[model samples]
Target chain A: MTQVSDAPAKTRAQISQKTLRTDRWWEQPAIVATLLTIWVTYATVHVFIGKWYWVPQYHYLTPFYSPCVSGECVPGAASLGTWFGHLPPIIPYAVVSLPFVLGFRLSCYYYRRAYYRAFWRAPAACAVREPHQKYTGETRFPLIMQNLHRYFFYMVILISILNTYDVIQAFHGKTGGIGFGLGTLIMLVNVVLLWCYSLSCHSCRHITGGRLKHFSKHPVRYWIWNRISWLNARHMQLAWTTLGTLMLTDLYIWLVAAHVFSDFRFYN
Target chain B: MSYKAALRVWRGDHGRGDLADYAVEVNEGEVVLDVLHRLQATQAGDLAIRWNCKAGKCGSCSMEINGRPRLACMTRMSTFTEDEVLTITPLRTFPVIRDLVTDVSFNYAKARQIPSFTPDPSVGLGEFRMQQADVERSQEFRKCIECYLCQNTCHVIRDHAENENAFAGPRFLMRVAELEMHPADTADRRDIAQDDFGLGFCNITKCCTEVCPEHIKITDNALIPLKERVAGRRYDPLVWLGSKIARRPRSTGTPKVPDNRH
Candidate 1:
């Protein structure tokens, strides 16, 4: 090993500085914005479609309509009792609980990084200036609502459980006998993916265990936290896929309800 | 076997230059810095590369090895195949003083921008006592050796020179995190962090974490948690109500504005 004295303390001129990347920096932010815009538009319009979120024949309720807490929910479609009475005109049962789910995503550390850059253009890319001059961060007003992410995480967990219940209920055929179909399999995939997205949250990881002083004292928690760390590494990937699977699950259910095609039943 | 490897080294100053090719002799278990030292010793006597503590601790030898910000002393040459030509360059975010050495005054400027720890005077100087657990949280961030690699790889300033005025990059944000985590520090830095230090500029990309030789969880443990703290206190309605209650004097019992008008 060379002696530390070998390292010279030569300070060169503070000449011009910048990256040599000739590639346009705007490309990344552009792609992120485009994808987010498409997803948001689809979700917004899909949620308010006010129909086709469930198929009683399969007992499969698309995630967006779960707990279908509206007086207007189709008979037998309301998984939980309607609190606000049947759906009020145009406002779907999903909208009531939608705020909590949306709040979870909005406050998500991962999604916050995404939309803040893509939509808000807060330094849209590395080394680029933000469109706006001021930044109070989440410390101010609505942005501060991000702190409510943990509370929203709890609601999402309950909703995920409800969706799981819906999937189990799918096992019961339309006539109330045990059955299986392709829709059941699709719904299964959707709920599992949603679990991955919800459970991999940093808040979840922290709750399972973080800020610990002694690992040996609480071996079980340490073990669980170790597993969560692995999932957290792929949180973004899982989050993105859950979005796709969710839309697919809903679309499949919608098609079944529309009689576009009958669900392929394997058992009855 | 002593084999010769092609090294495409960037050989110029801030104004201009291109990758200059060289055939350097390879030996067993040698890092990139060793090869550069040999290159300077036997061939390019004046070839400039900044380094200290060939053992990767000092962090004085940050450079772009194949376009990634890494310590020259730590990047093992064996990581590359014999036929592969290793491309060496200075960190892209800062101005180059010479080959493989960048002007890191930008980091020093940021360090100055952060307020130093302000202890509560009641505890008296050097009398402050922090619990073992309290100090451990901050110990994680104190590992920084000021390699500035995190600063360089941070995209916030790497591409946008315009962002230099606003963004403090990851290294300094972790610095602020360390201080704010201190049990004895009396200052409220939430405003300084988000508003002035550009804490909001970081989008938790983990680029800085990836390049940190210290392996600090810069994005997760530091930046994200800091954002939570700033938002948590303000967003909690209970805290809001508590603040409102604490504002009026408890001695007054009832809320009343004392008459000062004469």
Candidate 2:
């Protein structure tokens, strides 16, 4: 509410006007379609291969549970071989991720801002006026699926531990070679996806001390954490990471559930 | 103690601008804005200055001194050396109309979009209860003076104008965050904030907090918490399931930069 008064006003000095480029060329339908096509296709393929082959082949842990031979598996499971014969724990993973993915997708505070910048005003400058874009329901379903992040974070950690335990169980047997199971593989991939998501969160970036003026000295021996916070200084990086990884994790799980290739097994 | 200082003031509007020099005599306890008024009364009777509640409470009298955003009324004239000249200009973010005044209607327009408070019918006024901590969180945001200094200093909207379409700026974001965090508030403006108002453009630079007159942690306490909630909702799978079970359709409204996003 700045105000001006009249009384023999001071002489005016003119500022030079520059021709501004005012169009959001990136958000055009053709571009949007191309980008989305590449993104979804890449995500679908990665999830399929990672869950089915890569995780099971490389990581000792698999998504499937093994049966109890001598109280090796959970109670009531018959043998070490029987427990490794079930579907990946989809219910637990989905249940844990529900709140995080759904809550944020419903709220949508961050995505709106991110897309506005990433799409419409990619190279942000001073004073470029553009009409607001009418937000159709395109990004909703996956955004609704975003609530899975926190729960995914929680589940992935738990599942990773479970997979670790499965690895230990494999060694206890005579073969000593960790056999791959589908469930252990899914859990392992879940952990990786969750890591990509959590490390990119806006909150986690701050805890890492992004752009903070200074840090305190008292927390002893954990100085390493403080140093890493410095690397997490770029706010936009965290914003993008948190955004992309959350969406990717959901895509991963959905693909696993869909069984796109069908051999992407979660159990023996 | 008596003091002497030179004031370099921007004395015109969008049509013209200049730094006019003036000498001022004041006591150690006086404020810079007070000195400007005095100089206006004696040396330059035609000079116009806008201010209210010379106390920092009203948020008026926001001006820049030596290239830094400040409340003229809150700045101590004693901080500058007697030989030094203080350069004063209206806040840079807004358009100057004549002198130290500019059209700030843009902020008002943004404020109008926020959804008003809507309490759930189940929690009647009489039975409503919340722990003291929840109430305290909202109290922190109540300190804003609307001086627009935070708005002025924000690089996203001030230095980077392209962000105006999506970014609601810091002041507005803090206000919305406040309301959203209110224990009794049932309105979920986060969707609106995301889709329309542009809360995500902030990037958490903390420059807004650095220049805030009242020292409210606009980024840390307010914006960041709201971001967490928004991010949580966007990604939390449990809430998604709950919405499905409860049959609550996802809201599709544009987020408005509410009067206060605290």
TM-score of chain A of 1: 0.88
DockQ of each: 0.12, 0.07
Cα lDDT tens digits for candidate 1, B1-262:
6689898888888735678899999898999999999889988998888887998889899987766678999988898889888877777777777887777877876676677776767887778655654566588898888999888877666655556766777888888877766667666666667766777666676668877888988888788767655544444564466667896221211111112211
Docking class of 1: incorrect
Please tell me which predicted candidate would have the highest TM-score against the true structure: 1
Question: How well does model 1 score by local distance difference test?
Answer: 0.74
Candidate 1 regions off by >4 Å? Answer: A1-51, A67-72, A80-93, A112-158, A161-173, A177-196, A203-234, A244-248, A251-268, B1-4, B14-19, B81-85, B118-136, B183-187, B234-238, B245-262
Error of 2 at A263 (Å): 52
For each candidate, the alpha-carbon lDDT, in order, equals 0.74, 0.54
TM per candidate: 0.73, 0.52
Residue A238's lDDT within candidate 1 is 84
Best candidate, DockQ-wise? 1
| lDDT tens per residue, model 2, A1-268 | 1111221112222222221222343354344445445655754444234232212322332232221222223332232233233334332212232343434322333444444444544223222222344332222464344333344445444544553454444332123354434434444445554444444444454334331211232233224334543433343354445435434444543444455533243233
Residue-pair clashes per prediction, in order, are 9, 79
Model 2 misplaced stretches (Cα beyond 4 Å): A1-268, B122-127, B235-262
